[model samples]
Target chain A: MELLLTYDVSTTTPAGRNRLRRVAKLCEGYGMRVQKSVFEIVCTEPELLTLIDKVQRIIDHDEDSIRIYRVPKGSFRTVRMFGTAKPLPHDDALIL
Target chain B: MELLLTYDVSTTTPAGRNRLRRVAKLCEGYGMRVQKSVFEIVCTEPELLTLIDKVQRIIDHDEDSIRIYRVPKGSFRTVRMFGTAKPLPHDDALIL
Candidate 1:
């Protein structure tokens, strides 16, 4: 399954800044960083659990926020793009 | 339709910071800010177009990016949340 992970790690303190870096590094191991704090990951249920566990350990529950969303198949078609980033490549039909 | 807009407006320069603030302010007019730079908006196609137009004018094509994603119906069920933010309410089986 494809998952989109979005997070808001407080940076008001030095420890919070470090946690932000650690969390981003952990997620980079599993997915592509589509936005500064958003990642697009493709993995199995077990893998997802492991990633979630690591993130849980790194964040302060009362100070940070994290949300993981499952992206349904074919959702690429619903993305509309603008600006510098490449619109995610999509090729639904191509006859040879 | 429901849309999720994510943006990365360069903040290294004064003008970029201004653009970031402006872009965020504009999005706030139409939706809820879910993350530091992400918004969840519920609106019509024409409304979306107006928003897209405004955002386009504020960003620097070579330095910033913006992406709008359409949220599929029932996607709220797919959200797995953690931390300070409230898990969005899901009442799929509520009988009361």
Candidate 2:
């Protein structure tokens, strides 16, 4: 399935900052960066679980939040992008 | 339709930073802030167009990017949120 993952990590402290990096690195391993704190990932159910486990371990429930959206198949047809956010050839422009 | 809006605004210059603040304020008028740069908005088609017009006028075509995703009807049932990202009582939890 296709997923839209976005997170907000508290960065006011050294620990929070470190957690942000670790979470971002984990997300980078599984998907394309949609923005500084957002990612688009396509993975199997098992892979999704694995990714969730990793993220949960790194985030503080009181300090961070993550939103995982299931992008309906073909929903990309309705996606609108402006300026340099235009899809690249190898990006989701060809595949969702 | 329901919309998930996100933007990346260049903040390297004073003008860019000012645009960023203006863009965020504009978005705040139309939607609920889901994160630092993400928003969840529900509006009529015409409202969406108005928002597009306003944002386009404020952003730099070369340095800024905006993405608007149409959230499928009832698809919010599948949304997964962790920590502080959970839906609130008056939020899309009851609408959309």
Candidate 3:
């Protein structure tokens, strides 16, 4: 399944980059970084659950932060093109 | 850019659904739900960062449990077809 995960960083600080990089490493093979603080990961129910657990550990923010919205499978196309009128070549390659 | 986001729910409980729904509503137009607990949202840097802040407000989990990986653009196709050999039509429409 396609997943859209977005996070809010404290700042453009080294700590933030380190945190994001760590997340990238853990999500290796299962996710792709579409933006600086956004990621897309694919996995089944069990695997997805496991990854979420890992994410919780990865971002140890004391203040409640980090929001994830689970969009239905085909919804990516509409959402991706919402703001941008033209289709992006990079996203076209994301087609299954 | 394309984004894939995955989340972990406590259970298939009412609260979980409500939480997910809240997130869905907040992320409306920018994300799609590809799975029960996973979604794909597309947004720019500022928008994504803002969304993350809203997420924290929706899911008030004392224990950290949401992990987000920001995959670079064009990485979704590779990861989507990783385990499944055959391509799914639903995802195809997701192409930009």
Candidate 4:
């Protein structure tokens, strides 16, 4: 599955900044960064669960927002990009 | 349907900035802004089509990227927010 992960981590405090960095790092391990706080992760169902669990643990449930949108494989057909950043490349090259 | 709209408008030029403002204004007419470049909109299929068309016109497809994620209605149950911004309000109060 292809998952679109978007998050907003509160950075009002020192701890919040740390959390933000940590979450970004964790996401990098799972997929490529599409935007500053957005990532395109291609993984299996179990991997998705683990990713969510790890992210949920690092975030302050009261001060952060995280959403995971499950994108069907090959759904990029509906996507239109008109910028430097190309759409997710095809090929299972991203699968772990 | 509930749609999550995210976009990255290039601001390297004066024209790009104008495009950004125009696109944002168009989105405001459709739904609530969730982040700087993110919005949560509740609308029907026709409304969604209208939004895509208007946005496509305002953006420089070669320098901007727009993504519309179709979120199933009542799917907010899986959404977790831990910040000052609450989730989309219920009650179909936004239907047009």
What is the Cα-based lDDT of residue A50 in candidate 3? 76
Q: What alpha-carbon RMSD in Å does predicted model 2 have with respect to the real structure?
A: 4.1
Fraction of native Cα-Cα interface contacts (under 8 Å, chains A and B) also present in model 2: 0.74
TM-score of the first chain alone, every candidate: 0.77, 0.76, 0.68, 0.77
Off by over 4 Å in 3: A1-96, B81-96
Ranking by DockQ: 2, 1, 4, 3
Candidate 4 wrong stretches, greater than 4 Å: A9-22, A56-63, A82-85, A93-96, B10-22, B60-62, B80-85, B90-96
Query: Fraction of reference contacts reproduced per prediction?
Result: 0.73, 0.74, 0.00, 0.28
Encode model 1's per-residue lDDT on B10-83: one tens digit a residue: 56589988988898788877766777777666667888888899899989988888877777665555567788
Model with the higher DockQ, candidate 1 or 3: 1
How much is A71 displaced in model 1, in angstroms? 2.0
Tens digits of per-residue lDDT for model 2, A7-96: 887555899779878887887666667666777776778888988988999899887899988876654445788867865221432221
DockQ of every candidate structure: 0.55, 0.62, 0.04, 0.34
Query: lDDT at B81 for candidate 4?
Result: 49
Best by TM-score: 2
Off-target runs (Cα >4 Å) in candidate 2 are: A10-17, A76-78, A88-96, B10-17, B89-96
Alpha carbon lDDT at B87, candidate 1: 48
- Sorted on lDDT, best first, the list reads 2, 1, 4, 3
Q: Which RMSD values do the candidates have, in order?
A: 6.6, 4.1, 14.4, 4.2
Put down candidate 3 lDDT per residue, A18-61, tens digits, no spaces: 76687666665465554444555565677777776777776746
Best by lDDT: 2
Model 1, residue B61: displacement in angstroms? 1.8
lDDT pick, better of 1 and 2: 2
Q: Which ten residues in a row have the lowest lDDT in candidate 3 chain B?
A: B80-89
**What DockQ number belongs to candidate 4?**
0.34
